[model samples]
Target: MDLKEQYEKLLRYCYMLTKDVNLAEDIVQETYLRFWQSHTYKDTNKELAYLYTIARNLCMDEFRKPKLDDIEDYCELSGESEYEPEARIDSLVIEEALEQIPKDLRELIVLRFTNEMSVTDIAKIVGISRFAVHRRLKEGLMLLRRNIGGEAND
Candidate 1:
């Protein structure tokens, strides 16, 4: 697949994880930059996974930083109507629900759905077994459904 074709996927992957378009764009650009800067950049087959890994690590680093309460006063992002209200609402709901999940589970859901990556590829990226990937994906989506007002299985 063309690397350019993966741009939107990468953007969505980062955005869902960060919930910030500007940060997502930066992460996508940095993902490409890091790939080019590496000495082991010859492998074409692993490029997609490598790009994801870079983006994921960048988001992780951002999450590790201590957040300031005052930062919110100046950090609101503005945008126009790019998506339909219903679609946007659904995304907003899902994102909010994702925030309630544990970080690890949220990562699994983003990688599986936003990135459209297979369990095997996710396993490789996350350094876990394929079985663990499947288990986590299932558990993560279940949590999302419940959080998003789906019929609770209780």
Candidate 2:
């Protein structure tokens, strides 16, 4: 695929990480820049996936830094809207629920649903077996359903 298509995918992946469009764009640009500077990304077929791995690592690094009190201000400056009342409530509920899950399982959900990456691709990216990916996905979905106020059967 071309750079444009790869970029679109990167943008979506970054947005899933930060939930801020401008931050996502910045992360995508940084990912592309890193990819361009690296020797491993010359092949167009693997470039998209390579860029995603870079973007994901960057996001994880950012999350590791200490948070500031003005983080919300930064997010707003980046054009992220304040959540509506219901959405805010739902977000809080979800956040709380996600926190209850182990980091590994949460990462799997982020890779699978947020990025829309395939199970095989996720297995490759995460360096886990396909069976492990499937198990984590199933467990994560169950946790999400319970946390989001839905019945476990759903």
Best by lDDT: 1
Instruction: Please give the distance, in angstroms, between residue 81's alpha carbon in candidate 2 and its true position after superposition.
Output: 7.7
lDDT of 2 by residue, 1-154 (tens): 6677767866866665676776678888887778778645556455445667788888887778886669777666656354322347655766667757777788788778755778887887777899999998999989877776652335
Query: What lDDT score belongs to each candidate, Candidate 1 first?
Result: 0.75, 0.72
Lowest summed lDDT over 10 consecutive residues: which window, candidate 1? 77-86
Q: lDDT of candidate 2 vs native?
A: 0.72
**What would the TM-scores of all predictions be?**
0.74, 0.64
lDDT of 1: 0.75
Q: Residue by residue across 90-129, what tens digits does model 1's lDDT show?
A: 6776777888989889988888887778787788778899
Worst 10 residues of 2 by lDDT: 78-87
